[model samples]
Target: MTTTLFSAFWTYTLITALTPGPNNILALSTVTSHGLRQSSRVLAGMSLGFLIIMLLCAGIAFSLATLDPALIHILSWAGAAYILWLALRIATSPPTDAAVQSRPVSFWASFGLQFVNVKIMLYGITALSTFVLPHTRELVWVVGISVLLAAIGSLGNLCWALAGHLFQRLFRRYGRELNIILALLLVYCAVRIFY
Candidate 1:
């Protein structure tokens, strides 16, 4: 039972963390521009944001299991629309110069962004309501799974960031190409949310 539970937990965490989302996009941008050291702050902020969202979702799940399914569907559609907006922003934004630097995004900005991060919110609610066991143990398992998911997600982001850091020179030379790729990825994610 323990082994099966652990396996299921990690599998869910891996899938949720690895999916393209605003947090991953931000992490990619931060690491590409700022490198890992500075980007670590963004990762920390993102992790905290996930923790907050997960806890809230777990609480809501426990207390309001009886919430109107129609309401959940409404929130889900709203979240999907918001993700499309974000994707449009990413697709249209100008790429930053890798050589000439700007300050990294503030912790508060990163933290607050998660509230509107549709992917993370959906993942949190889904994982809490589906994968983790026992309604009575919802909070505990939700928090534990959240922490694990955050750590794993951060690691995935770190890997992407490191890739961006290592290829910074290439990005500088081919900024337009990189932006197009990122834009496509975001758009794909946005579409996925709906379908």
Candidate 2:
């Protein structure tokens, strides 16, 4: 990739990593209600999941030589369905103070969720196809980018968790609204995957 393209790719990557997707919303909600300790596990699980996706993208990119346009659409739809399911869970979540019955999101669950998460997977695929494959197709480049993506993802989730921790104090009086808004945004993110 040219210097201009490289700069653009990194910018796109940073924006996507920091955006309010399901992962961020979940991290934000978890820390807001459960605390950073709980959210940190979730963040770790999410990072592992992203690494898995990045490797998967690397394999797909290297093997297929080109991604099928139809496959992208199919994956997007499947991911959207899964995200909608998560949105339902978020929508029904009780307020932080009254959520005694709800279980915290487990690490395994978060890790598994990444496999079907269209946002992160699509992000990986986009990076692979747009930046890595076109530029060098070198194994080293692919691996390096994947590692960078994992680090970026980790930092982004951490930031979201920290924001949630801080917001816990600020939104103490409006907890329900926060949950509702997060749930709605999750739904929006799911819908956006298809379009």
Candidate 3:
């Protein structure tokens, strides 16, 4: 790849990874409503999810003649539903150390989520097809880009989660209110994905 193309690829990765999508938004909300320690799991999950999705998208791009429209449709709906469920959970979640206990998002759940994470899936396909695939068919570059993007995205998620922790100071005064707002934002993101 040309130097300019490589720089553009990284630029795209940085912007999308840092953008407040399902992974970032949910992770931020988790840390805010819960705590950084508790939210770490979600951030880990997002990284894993992104990695898996990138690999899968690369595979499909390499092997398939065309990306299946039906699959994209199914993924869109499924992802939206999952995000909606997460929104509900976040909205109704208890304050830290309250009467009720809610389990943090598990690693497996987070890892599996990439299968339907349309944004990351599309990003992966677009990256591989536009930037990497045309340059060479070598698996090394594809895997390298995928792994690198995942690492960068992990940092992005970490920063967002940390921002949530930073907001914990104000949370004591308005936890539920903040949760509702974040939850609503999640719902907005979910709905926006389809429209």
Candidate 4:
């Protein structure tokens, strides 16, 4: 890739990863509610699932030559619906005590979420198809870039998780307000899918 494209690619990647999305939002909420130690499983699940998605995007970068617009529309709708449901859950869920018995989002549930996470789907697809694939078609390069992208995305989630962990006490004091704000942010993310 040219220097210009390389710069652009990294910029896009950072922006997408750092911005609030389902994964980041969930991570923050999970940590705020359950604490960092308890939230590890959820973060691990998201990272693993995100890595898998990035790998799939490498394959999809080639096959997307014949992708149907209708399928894209269908996916968008489904993703939006799922995000809305999550928003509702976030808004309604009361904060839990870390020492008490509470069910946080499990590894399996978070892993499955990646399959329908449209923001992540679009992020990986665009990064590979536009930036990585156009620059090189070598298998090693593609896989490497995918892994790097996954790492960057995981870092983004961790940033949010850390923020939540750092402010756990303040968040707990105003848990209801925080939940409402997070839910609204998630709703914004869902609505952005249409455009």
Candidate 5:
């Protein structure tokens, strides 16, 4: 890739990773409700899941060139529906109080979430196709780039988790309102999938 294209790719990757997508939002919510210690498991799971997705994207990038458009549409619908369900759950969740006995989000739960997260799937695929594939067709290079992108995304998740930890007191005070807003943002994400 040319220097300009390389710069553009990194810019896009960073912006997308840092943005409030399902993974980052969930990391923030988990840390806010539970503490950083408990939430670390979810964050780790999300990172692992993201790495696997990126690896898959690396392999699938070539096949996707000839893949049917309908398959992508079907996946999008499923992802949006799952995201909407998550939004409903978040919207109805109770406040984060010591008296409340809500179960912390499990590693498996967060791991499973990545499978349905459309944003990161597209993020990986787009990065691979638009930036990496044009420059090289070698498997090693493709996988390496995907892994790097996944690391960037994982770092972004950590940033969100830390933000939640730092603002835990404030979040606890307005937990309900913040949850509602997060749910609304999730709803917007789901809606955006269609358009």
Candidate 6:
């Protein structure tokens, strides 16, 4: 049973990590503006923040069994708004020659941003509630799952960042098109949250 549960947990974690979300989007953007080597620090900060958030979510799920759906909806809406704001910032920002010089996102900023990242919170709660066995064993499993998921999610972030790096030329060549795509993605996420 433990092995089966762990397998399911791993699958869930992978799917959650690979999916498009605010963190992934930000990571991609950072990579495009900077580079993968520089954006790695941002990924580190994000992973650390995600680990902390996942641990909190695991504890809440184990103790509460369920979370308030209304709160989740509110969080989702807030996340969507934030994404839209980011998209707008990207669209309107003037191109800088200095941006090619690798600049890392500040750790505190990355940590704080992850706090309101709805997708990570939802993923944590889902993993804790679904895969963890009920009891003391559940707590142990939750910790293990959270750590493993954090690692996997970090790798997924790296992949997204690398994708941005590989396509940096394309981004530079077709800046307007990329902005439109990003704006559409933000709008889609916003609509999805309400629907």
Instruction: Name the best candidate (by lDDT).
Output: 4
lDDT (0-100) at residue 26 of candidate 6?
70
Clashing pairs in 5: none
lDDT of each: 0.68, 0.80, 0.77, 0.89, 0.87, 0.74
Over 1-195, each residue of candidate 3 has an lDDT whose tens digit, in order, gives 799998999898889888867777777766776688876777777787788777777789888857879888898899888888877877887755561256677777766766667778777888788888888888888788778777877777888888888987676467678778778877887887788
What TM-score against the true fold does each predicted structure earn? 0.79, 0.91, 0.88, 0.95, 0.95, 0.85
Pairs with steric clashes in candidate 3: none
**Tens-digit lDDT string for candidate 2 (1-36):** 789998988898889889988888888877887788
lDDT of candidate 3? 0.77
When summed lDDT is taken over every stretch of 10 residues in candidate 6, the lowest stretch is: 93-102
lDDT of 5 by residue, 1-195 (tens): 889998999899999999988888888888888878888889989999999989988888956674467877888898898888878878888867951367767898889888888899899999999998888898889989989989999999999999989999999899999899989988998998888
Off by over 4 Å in 6: 2-7, 94-98, 101-105, 134-136
Query: What clash pairs does model 6 have?
Result: none
Clashes of each: 0, 0, 0, 0, 0, 0
Candidate that beats the other on TM-score, 1 or 2, i.e. the better one: 2
Q: What is the lDDT of residue 189 in candidate 5?
A: 89
* lDDT, candidate 1, at 175: 62
Q: Order the candidates by TM-score, highest first.
A: 5, 4, 2, 3, 6, 1
| TM-score for predicted model 2 compared with the true structure | 0.91
Pairing residues by index, what is the TM-score of model 4?
0.95
